[model samples]
Structures are given as structure tokens and as C-alpha cells.
Target: MSDTAPTSVVDQVLAAVSELLPEIAASAAERDRTRSLPRYVLDLLSSAGAFSVTVPTTHGGPGGGAAVAFEVTRLLATADPNVAQIPQSHFVYLRLAELAGSASLLDELFGAVLTGERVANAQSERTGRTVTDQTTRMRLVDGATVVDGRKFYCTGSLTADWIAVLGRDEDDVEQVGFVRAGTSGLTIVDDWTGMGQRTTASGTITFEGVRVDPSHVVPRQRAVTGPHGYGAFAQGLHAAIDVGIARGALTEAAAFVRSSTRPWFEADVERAEQDPLLVQRFGELEVDVRAAESALVVAGAAVDAIASAPPSRVDDVAREASLQVAAAKVLGDRAALAVTSALFELGSTRSSDDGLNLHRHWRNARTHTLHDPVRWKLQHLGRWSVAGTPPPRGPQF
Candidate 1:
């Protein structure tokens, strides 16, 4: 947990998340096998107010900040990584609205989300190469924009009621838009079947002459640069997922070591936990987990400070917040990998029905970290710090 003032609402959120762990774990295998998120789980999350944390109180939302969101995500991830990640892409767009001070948009978008309407990201493409080159083009036609393009890795597409899409304008600058699900000329092609997070239902979304009203276009008058952007929020959430993976791995390993009796006893050892090396390994993983979590706290504080600042200080604050986000992601990602690997090795189970999904933790951690590897991102941050050059722009944050 981050060392900040704990709100009752945050505690309520944690309680809601904690209560879902059993259901999440129970459904993990089914979700992976089916390659789809169960509708019931999503309904449960909506009713719990999970998606309303970023929206303002005046708008009938929880009015929470990035840190509270991080905690909720981490808790959910401890049980099911796929389900935990499903809400992040939508919440990221909501956070963007908050940063932009687009309260009207937030009210409309979040009201729908609070009623179980899922949202997804239609940004990443097979050949969209950079943020500047949006392969998807939206052209003005009569009173609306006609969209034609293919978006890849559209997580939660199976359940989303709307998708926030990025397209190229006449000037080739990237702009964001929203299209309601089940709209004409829209198609969702199921394509995701990865080794991990298969339940995310991440696939390809196609828009062929999909008509979007002018009001649906997310304006880009202000260049989203400097600080106070998506990067800060993403780092905090990614770090939380990393830490959650570690915690899950450790918990599984600890339970296995404590109960599973083995026959490879040297003298009088009855279980793997009796081994000195296993004990030492557990301690090492615990230390790494704690360290990574602490780094996340520091990063969260940096993000909160920047988010609370006046509009004039946003750009510089965003840049500084970027560094902290990178640091947290790098450290937390490494710790998750380490702890999960150690847990697998410590567990001496040979059967697949050991009632422990050790490999899933590592697989989820490995796959999700690719969203933006902390190592490369850290180098970018260092480059900005040393060269005093503007950091490269990415699709999110």
C-alpha cells in the first residue's frame, strides 16, 4: 500500500476488490479456455463502483485519484490478471478526460460505464508505427466523420459498449474519437489468443465507413506533452500490476511450502519449506516485493502532486512525473518476474492439478510488461534528463 492518507472510499473500494478474489480465481481457467471475459464478472465490477473512481463527486462518481485507482487495480490483479487489465484501458481514457477538464464528456461517458458499459482502446495497429502516423483515417463527410481502419490489440472489445479510437486528420496529426459499439460498419474480429491474459479478449477492431458525429470527436487543440498526461497514470497502474503479480506468486508459494509434504527429505525434512534454501528464497522474494511496492508509493506521490497543481505548472510537472513513473515500472516489473520465477522453482508439484496456477503469474507479468518495457522507457527518461531533449511521444501518456 502507498503511504498516504487513506480515505473511507478507498477502503470501500479495496473491500469490494477483495471480495471478488475468489470469483476471479475460480473463473480464471474458464476465461482463459474460452478466451473471453465472463459477462457476470463485469456486471459485478460495475455494481461495485470500480469504474467510477476517476470521475468527480459532483458528477456522481467516487472522485478518487491515481493512487486509489492503483490500489484497486493491484488488489483485483492479485486474483485475475486478465480481469484486472480489462478496466485499465477504459479508466485511462476517463483519466484523460479529467486531465483535460472535459467534465461534460466525463459525465456522459462515465454514466454509461457505471451502468456496465465497457470501453476499450482502438489505438494500437499492426503498422501504425508511431503516434504521428495514425493508419486509421476519419474524413469529414456531410455532418459526421467516416472512419475506415483496423485497430489491433483492442482489449475488452468483446464487452465494450464504446471504444475510444485514435485516427489521422487531414494534416496527419493523431486525434481521438469515440464510436458506440454495435454501430453500423463496425466489426470486431476475435484475434487474441496469447499465452497469458487470454481472457482479456484483446482482438482486432475494424471500422469501415463507421459514422461518428462531430460531438463524438475528442478535440486535440492542446498538444498532450510535458506532464499531467497518460504516462503518469499508466506507470502507477503498471507498477501496481507488477507488485500484485509478486504478491500472488509469493502467496501461492508460501501456501505450498507450508502444507505440501514431500519425500526428498535429507534427514527429517517432510516438506519443501523445511529446506534452508527455500526459506532463504522466500525471504529474498519478500524483500524484493517490499522494495518494489515502496518505489511505487514514491511514484504515486509524485503523480498526485503533479495532478493537484495549477494548470500553469502542468507541463513541467508532467515531465518530472514521467521519470518517477518509469522508475516504478522498471523496478516493479523486475520484482514481479523474479518473485514468480522463484515461486515456481520452490514449488515441487509435478501435476497440473496442484490447485496452484504458478505459471499464470509469470506469464501475465511477462506479457503485460510488454505494454511498455520499463528498461527501454527508463533509458528514454534518462535521455531526457541528460540531453534536456523532449521525450518521444507515445500513444498513451
Candidate 2:
């Protein structure tokens, strides 16, 4: 583990992130087979300062902003999409801290983030009619906030030091309750058995009368107020992760073909790499990967743009960021699905051997991309393109 200082130059930040990829990629297949990521990888990432890119400079961080942070996510995803995604909510809550978290709350959470302590999210419910529907409820009991509800798809809940639970209060407003892991009545079950992203631990969390500090709960109003860029940033990160999976799949496809795959008999070629059709297919996958990467670049810059815009211009930047992030989502989904599928197709039958576990990329891409529907993303872009209608402001958009 490299010890990275808090004040980050973009290059140094990227370098630190780069250093971890080889080790991560080397062990990725095995970890996926076992369905567990080592906890120390988080520590190594923290020690490397990968999680602090979004931390403001005033707080002894580099404040590398959205673009750099997405870049980090993309690189990590190429190694292990599960590990890459584990902290997605950690970053989300960092932005939430900016919204409704009190200054003291900010200090505590940001401090934990800068040190690489993980914060998991407990937001989506298993039985909700829609993504935003909440069955979990929070109410006041003896001047203390008491939470009771079950959350599913609670990604990273088991791995986190703290859990941020989204719930509806008596007033019917969505709010987040921050609870320490293992708090009484808080149970994080390792029940995630998704075909892909199997190690994400995206399972069920039950908050049965969990007591939460009032100050630890972020008010929904403040979190939703102002020129919101969290949606764009979050979506952009999702795009980055998908693109990384594509890149990883493409890379492994080429390597597996070169090392192990025999050319089709009709091709009359000694090497699969020399097969004209395989080469063409690889080229096509590369194009898709490039397009997705380019889209993320554009969208990430738009996310960065939102930080410095004046209040009058905030709406414009915010819309642009959302539109571009939506574009990234579309392109990313296409590339990840295409490239990961092509991996086995290009490498031939031996690639499917369970021992290689090459299928993990496609599995991860399929499972993780389900976090949001790409069709809705396309609809938003289509609506924006045809009528100049901005996407509705919400977590999904």
C-alpha cells in the first residue's frame, strides 16, 4: 500500500490508483469465485487516497472533482467491477454530506472518507413500487429518532463502517439516517446471490427500531435543494464503471486469444489473432469501448462544470451535466454488454471454462447495469434532443 498525502495533484492521484490495478486484476477471478473481496483492499485504496479525490481541499484533500474521481472508478472497474462499485455510495454520501450534513457531520464523515473508511447505502427497498418508494419509516420516540424498516439491494452494507439508511419520516419526506455498523437492531445479512457482482454484498439490511442520532440524519430538503449535481455525478460514475468492465473484457479477450485460443479451422490461420474476422470483431468492440470512454469524458467534465457555476448559471450546467451523463449511460451500457459478450465469442470455447472465470465481466456488467434502466436514460436523451426538454431532476435522471 502506498501512503498518499492528502493534497493531491491529478497525476499523483491517478498514479496511485494505477498502482493498484495489477494486484487487483490478478486476484479478481478468484475473488469473484469466492464471492468476497478482501477488506484490506479497501485499506490499500484508502492508503492510496483513491476515495479522497472528491474531498474539498479546505479539508486537507486534493478535491480532484468529478472527472478525476470517475477516472479512478473506471480504472478500478477494469480490475474488479465489484471492488470498483463497492464505494459508489461512499461517494454519493459525500455529496449528501455537502447538502444536509451539519458542519460537524461533514467533518466526521469527510474525515472518515479521507482516511478511506467505507460508508454503505441502505436506500432501495425490495417491495417498492418504484425506486423512490420507501417502506422504511423514521419517527421520533422520546426525543430520539427511531428507524424501522427493511432495505434490499443495500450495496456495500456489510463492508461499510457506517450505513446510510434512506427512509420516509412522519411528514412523508425522504431522509437519510446514518448508523454505525452493528448498531442494535441493525442487521446486514450477506445474502446477495446475484449471478454477477456476486461479491458486492448487495443484500438485505433490516433496521428494526434502530436508534439514530438526530444530527446524524440528513434532512431531505437540504439534500434536494440547490443546483443538484449528485445525480449526474453518480450516473457518470456508473457509466465509468461499465466502460471499465468493457475495457477489461476486451483486454482479456485479446490476451486469451493470443495465448490459448486456436484459430477456427476454416480460417487456415495458425493464430486466432491472425484470423481476419476475429480481428474485425475486436476492432468493433474497441470502437464501442472508445465511444463509451469518450462519452464519460464529456459527461465527467460537465459534472466538474457544475462545481464553479454561479447560481444563475447553475441550472444550465446542471442540465448539461445530466444530459451528458445520460448519454454516457447509454453508450456505456452498449459497450459493456457488447464487449463482455464478445470476450467469450472472440476467445472461443475454452474461455468459458469455469476455471478461467472470464464470464465474470459479462455477469458483472449485466447485474450492475440493472441498477438503472438504460431505456429510461435513452428516453431522457431523446426527449432532451427532440424538444429541448431537460431531464427531470431526481436520483435516476
Candidate 3:
């Protein structure tokens, strides 16, 4: 695909996000210090239509597609990673709803999304030795579906209007059931103490016989496979987050070197920016960032194309999209880690200021990048390239 300027709804949304970066950056430190949700920032993003980036235009959303959503996510991550992460699952759930939900169900959820309501995911559980294994159960009880289980890494649940709980039905079929945020028997706990992305509210959520509407339950398999390329789209969002983190790190590095950093005594350069070694390091970092950005853009376009294609070709398109996204993920992970860690090298003492909290960038990158192992992503990509193998149909790829 040819690289062109972003236009239409994508351009509009990206412009809006760019305008909010200053304010988002201003509050980022405080939010990180307190590990509190940036509700004000989230409200601003919602008003700017950030949450509606991927919702269908027919459903009163911008309908900017996967590429547009990826751009928005990358911009948001640059300003505040915690806030950026809050909506990752929201997009995934919305895509799944569009792919598998019934007409009435889609209308209801999409309408809520357009009105600034958010959906949180309660999918990961500690009981499962493997990521795909689930102990959570959703069974029909007296004409109503009841969900009973505990969930960990339930990102964005604390502030969401609705929760999408992933579980297996009586027949062990994977399914997702939506429940209102404050429904009876539903509990959201802000207990996450991770080293990075602290404000994401990725904690434990408990559902003790929480009742779910029958219409709200959708088969996960249907959405995971279809013409939408939902898995690739989801992975693209993650890659965007990593790219944003890298960009943020590089931006900070440039500012500090030009203004506050001192040149090495032996080199005798007037400014840190003039130091040849530092300049070379910056050049190297910039190349890495640009390469990751290019990869993400291409992968995102592939996902968008697959999403818009006919269902007959979805399987083939999804495989290709998955391989592309896997490659992007690897690049994004390396770029973010390198840039964040390298920032400290410019001026270690000054960068260590308690208030600046520069280390948080590395912390966030290190923590969030561990969401999935990059080695496996590389393995999959290598397998695809050398052996003509396709990645398995799952969310992580």
C-alpha cells in the first residue's frame, strides 16, 4: 500500500488527539505518581470521539477503520500510556460486537459507545495455566445466564459503564457476556500494583452469580474468525501503544539534550545536542522509531483491508494480516525498550529527578511490552517467512 496523508474521519480524529497532548502530558506525572485513573483526560478523549474511532459509521460512529484507530491509539499513548491502554479492550469488544452480535444487541452497544459509555474486558484469569484455558463458567440458570468466576488483569473495569466477561458455557464453548458496571454480585477492585501502566486499573474483578442478558452473550469463535480480521486489529492496537511509548521517550530525550543536558567534559562540545556521539545515538534511535512506525502503518492498513474484504477471503486475509502485525509488534517492542532505556544515558543524574519520573517511561514500556512475549511473536513471524506457515487463529497474534 502507498503511504498517503491521513484524510476524512481519520485526519479529524488525529487532529483532535494532537490538540489534547499538552494537557494530557501535563497530568501524566501526577496520574502516574498517584496511580489514579485520568478521568478528566478520558472525558476529553471521549468528547473528541476517541472511543468511537472504530465503531461503524452506520451506528453513528466515525468509522475510521483499523488504521485510523491505530493512529489514534499511538498518539494517545505518547501523552499518557495508562489512559491509552484503557480503551484497547473497548475497541476489541466493539469489533467483536460488530462481527458476532445480533442486530438489536449491536445497536444497543454501539449506541452506548457513541454516547461515551465504555466497555471493560474481564477475560484473563489466574486459574488457567495456559492463556486460553478458562475456569470461569457461564451457565443457564432459570431462564437467565449467570456468570460465576474471578478475573485478573481486567483492564479498565474500574471506570467502565459495562463489563464484558469472558467465560465458557455449560458445553465449554467460549463466550462473552456483558453485564452492567454496578450490577448486583459484580465487584471491581483496583488492586493492580504493577511497575508500569499503573493507572490502567488492571485489577481483579469478581462475578458471583452475576446475571447476564441472553442477548448480551456472543460466541467468541464467531468473532475471532470472520471477515473483520479482529485478532490482527487487536494486535495492531498493542503495537501502536509500544510505538507511542517509543515516540514519547524520543521526544523527551531530544528536549532534555537540547536544554538541560551538559556535554561531556572530554568532547568539549558547547551543547549536548552538538556532541557527535549523542547526535549519532539520536540518529540511531530515530531510525528505529521510524521503522517501527512504518511497520505499524503497513500492518494497520493490511488489517483494515482485510476487515473490509468479503467473508469468503477473510481466512486468507487474516493470516496475512496476522503475519504483518506480528512483525510490527516485534519492531514496536524493540523500539520502545531501546528509546526508553537510552533516555537515561543522556543525563543520568538530571533524569533521575523525583518529580520528572523519567524512569516511568521505561517502567511503562517494560511492563506493558511484557503483555505478550516478543520471542513468540518473532518465532511466529520467522515460521511464516521461512516455512510458509500461518499463525494460529487467536487474539494475541
Measured by TM-score, the strongest candidate is 3
Least lDDT summed over 10 consecutive residues: which range in candidate 2? 220-229
Can you list the residue pairs that collide in candidate 2?
none
lDDT of 2 at 16: 86
Q: Mind giving the per-residue lDDT tens digits that candidate 1 earns over 225-277?
A: 54554666866787788877778778877876677635356636666677777
TM-score winner between candidates 1 and 3: 3
TM-score of each: 0.89, 0.95, 0.96
Model 3: per-residue Cα lDDT at residue 390: 82
Tens-place lDDT digits, model 2, residues 68-94: 878999999998898888768878777
TM-score winner between 2 and 3, please give it.
Answer: 3
Model 1 regions more than 4 Å off: 1-7, 34-36, 101-104, 130-132, 220-223, 261-264, 310-316, 349-357, 384-397
Query: Measured by C-alpha RMSD in angstroms, how accurate is candidate 1?
Result: 3.7
Ranking by lDDT: 3, 2, 1
User: How many clashes in each candidate?
Assistant: 3, 0, 0
Better of 2 and 3 by lDDT: 3
How does candidate 2 score on lDDT?
0.85
